[model samples]
Target: MSATFAGPITRSPHPASSASDRIHRLDIRDLDELSPDTTESHGEEGLTMRNQKEIRETSIRSARKLNIRELRALLGRCGMSVSDYDIEYVAALHGADGQPAYGASPHDGCGRPLPGNRGRPLILLSDLALADLETAVVTIYHEIAHHRSYRSVGHAGTEAAAERYGWRMYSEFVRQSA
Candidate 1:
């Protein structure tokens, strides 16, 4: 399936609407053509610096156009119920240990959860300017996975599970979009 972004983008508040339902999916193979220096690494393809920048810009534009309801719906698709949580787009994120990250979740070291939510998780998205659409979306899914893992199994094995969940969600999005 060829992924192509087409038509006028519209915002929908429906929880059933997913990224795959909205954005066109481009074939992963096609990404290489976008940059001459693209290469395969560690069994994964790497985009050139220029291509990365382009993807980031495009992602930012898409994210800015997405309304809060749409963002919430996207999270719902990832199996996260953020109806009570606060989702904020910020300049950047730092890990629980103070290192930068693409996204962070409630009290995970990126930042403190928003006050007054009564313990509902807070999802902090990095500024769109600093992340590609894929990274941003995946980060949201990743954080949600962390929330789920923490609740289900405690913190001992959250990272591996979250990483797997995030990548699986991302792959599905790509495949569905394609």
Candidate 2:
């Protein structure tokens, strides 16, 4: 398959402030830092993926293989109205080339929301949790479930909400993939 990388998402900076229903949580962790290279080595040569940078770059290329439209459509299928900006931001954070340092905690695998940042809507995604298409859809839908919760209630009831809607999100993703 042909793969084209989109440089980086930080090329266009986001506004400092936005509505509660349209903000994105920036997860600065580098998914590229982790190595998943399994390329076979040649005889007597301890040659491997070589450097972590190469491994990370390869990972970024692999993640970029997902179609953006398909990702948006996947979210739409689950009833979440996400903007192109949100998708790009999520993709950037999950992809390579975005600034590293900021990360989503608790939900470190994906992205995280700002603490005490009430009335702010955020979607954080991470390759750690959603490494492939199936998990990607699952993770995005899970965040959307949270968005739905926020829409219904000014703020969501953490424990009950997660438990109630978590599996539904996972199932919906599996269904869509199937």
RMSD in order of candidates: 13.6, 16.9
Q: Which number leads on TM-score?
A: 1
lDDT by residue for model 2 (23-127), tens: 223112211212222232111211100011122453443454555457777767755445522532333232222233111212111223322223244445544
Per-residue lDDT of 115 in model 1: 31
- After superposing candidate 1 on the true structure, give the runs of residues whose Cα lies further than 4 Å from its correct spot: 1-70, 73-85, 96-98, 108-119, 128-130
| TM-score for predicted model 1 compared with the true structure | 0.47
C-alpha lDDT of all candidate models, in order: 0.41, 0.34
Looking at model 1, report the run of 10 residues with the lowest lDDT sum. 42-51
Per-model TM against the reference: 0.47, 0.37
